[model samples]
Target: MNFAYELPWYRKFINESDLVFCDGFGVLWGAKLCGYCIKSDNRMTCPDYIENLALACEQENISLFLLAGKPGTVDKAIAKLKAIAPNLKVKGHHGYFEKIGDENEAIINEINKFRPDILYVGFGMPLQERWILDNLTRINAKVFLPLGACLDYYTDAVYRGPRWMTDRGFEWLTRLVIEPQRLWQRYLIGNPLFFYRVFRALIASSWKNYSKMSKFWRT
Candidate 1:
């Protein structure tokens, strides 16, 4: 019952599986294009991500922890989990971001001692993913889900746009409306850059797949 988490490089350990990279905007589309099963429920608040995750932990009877995100967010996140799924059993939890520096031995040490089955790090992409890539072996976990801003959104610490707006793929826009000053850079710069990279990857993958199929038929 070994589940391989996403780390693109960790593919070596996961001979056969999707190992999604925990991004509704990035890996979800990546998985769609690559034929891997990408799983996420973006229901505005989208507690399902953690809800399903809690179910996974309960089924496995393995320890789990929220390893990153703003202070107090994890506690707040847990409350929603309890509210949404009161019966769900969690092994344990912790949170501390911004304060943790590079090498973050304390964080690594704590995780190692508990040896959880899953580590849901919502420190945002690349950074969260990179954290897992750099630390997972040292820490104990079969699955690592690096979620970006998921904790804030899920915990209700931050607000999500209305359902209609979210459905239209402009939840980020609604967010900007709510927290204009704080979110300006994320929506203005990060959002566009994220889509650009996503689409670019899609194009590259499509061309590669077409080339492969064309060569196969030709031969």
Candidate 2:
């Protein structure tokens, strides 16, 4: 929601996406306030569902290429994934390379050579989304999945907090506590700001509807 609120282009990208799921409670609640029937069960965070995704891909004989995380982080995540699904075919590259010119071309060539069924890019929100928009036509992968910081959690490079907190939509609180220096603004200010925007939009929508009803009654 913050991404959409901050970057108008981001909303267009999401709307153009073939599939979009609720990855956080903010989006779920926002949808509810907008009169959508989204529920907690509909939320699927990558850290929570990644193992299952690997297992399912293994069973379905789908190949995965992970392009995210710092140096060595993606390799560690692939190692953990292989442990969970021994037969899973997966490869990975760190997201530290340049996104344009020679370096970007090389990475694209590498991915095309691998010909993965799914490509996971986790350079973070707007950047990852922009990369996909720019290179989707040239990429050989069948699916483009943007996962922010998921590999860090998979490799334990970043702590994801207890299951209790994460399961109950308090993962933001946990993250705020864990990386206060890095993420203070995102969770501290961004969360409340997101909700405020949601409510504002909801109220505006309600008033519009009420005005329409009033006109109908007068007619």
Candidate 3:
């Protein structure tokens, strides 16, 4: 729900990504309007994917690692995941560390020793993405999932709203109501800017298609 625009590094990372999934309602809606073949259910946030991830890892015996969040949030998230899939092999660390300093090396060493199948990092945007890219080869994980503030949701450090509100895309509103001062810019300003870009893209796409059709007819 945050940082959909105005971050050049993030955009560059996203463009270079091999696998990209819509992480928010705004992204999903924009994709649909742009004629993508994505279903609404496919637009899952991090909290929405934890259970399925835990189950899959439990069944396949794939080790998992939670590598982000506030001081205690990763531990709380680990506990919550254990409740869902008790047999799932998982370890975690807090996301408050320097990416290029001693802290980063310590984290990489821990993760390399564990050799997790999937490493979920919730260091928030741009940072999480950059962290993975910076240490992509050093980390022995098969998959690196960037989950922004997902740990907070699992730990109840952040309220994710009820199902009904979230289903209808009012989750942003709920968040704004809960933490207005912290989230005002994200929702109030960023949300509108995101939509405006989506609308502009839709129009441009339509114009391009029409032009192509007109040229084809003339030929």
Candidate 4:
């Protein structure tokens, strides 16, 4: 019922209503394929985004409930958040506890206890999106976002591209230069595969429209 309109990045939905945020480039790109409108700050450093978020939380007194990626990452992220916004309130921040399917009660418990205004889900994309879509009905947060790699990015555990590169959409290469070990596969293999699928989807859509036009002409 809450997910009435077409939603884009989790941030837009997050700022406005009860929702969750999902991260990961491919997932966000896929949202584009689905014709959703979301703000894309491909150049944003993870810390910069969180720093502003911290300011918002402190100023607004809005509680943030975090679901961090990988084990132990949440604690580290909280520490970084505290450094950014000394007075920021993290109602609840925890590492991944529930697996893909075994997440209902765990997430619901936090929602009931914290009733956070913001729910930052750090699970990677597609997975984060799927999780939020499945569990949003049970969530109490007014906003939920699945910001992929954003946590690590914020902690400076990962490197962000230069502003100019990001503006020109060459940020992917910058990442390769910064952390090739972590990203080689994602860019070298993953991006090419994604492009293929995206082009295929576009072609298919064009063909569908052409077929419809032909039918109308015959009629």
How close to the true structure is residue 62 of candidate 3, measured as C-alpha lDDT? 95
lDDT (CA) per prediction = 0.61, 0.91, 0.86, 0.68
| lDDT assessment of candidate 2 | 0.91
C-alpha-based local distance difference test score of model 3 = 0.86
lDDT score for candidate 1 against the true structure: 0.61
Give one digit per residue, the lDDT tens place, for model 2 in 1-219.
688767888989988889999888878877887889877999988988899999999999999999999999988999899999999999989999999999999999999999999999999878999999999999999999999999998888988889888887898887888889988998888988988988888889899999999999999
RMSD (CA, Å), each prediction: 6.5, 1.4, 2.3, 6.7
Per-residue lDDT of model 1, residues 1-219, tens digit only: 011233455454334434533434444554555576655553223353567766655666666677655667777776766665565544334444442575377777767787767677766544665566666567777767655677777767777767676655677787788888977986797656765665777789899999999999999
Clashing pairs in 3: none
Candidate scoring better on lDDT of 2 and 3: 2
Across 1-219, the per-residue lDDT of candidate 4 in tens digits comes to: 112123454444455644334334554666677687865753244445687887889889988887866666677778877886888878545546664445658667866687888888876654576678777788888877667677766666666677676555676898898878977986898777776777687889999999999999999
TM-score of candidate 2 versus the correct structure, residues matched by position:
0.94
Q: Which candidate wins on lDDT?
A: 2
RMSD of 2: 1.4
Residue pairs with backbone overlap in model 1: 124-148
User: In model 4, where do residues sit more than 4 Å from their true spots?
Assistant: 1-47, 100-104, 161-168, 174-185, 193-219
Q: 2 or 4, which is superior by lDDT?
A: 2
In TM-score terms, candidate 1 sits at 0.63
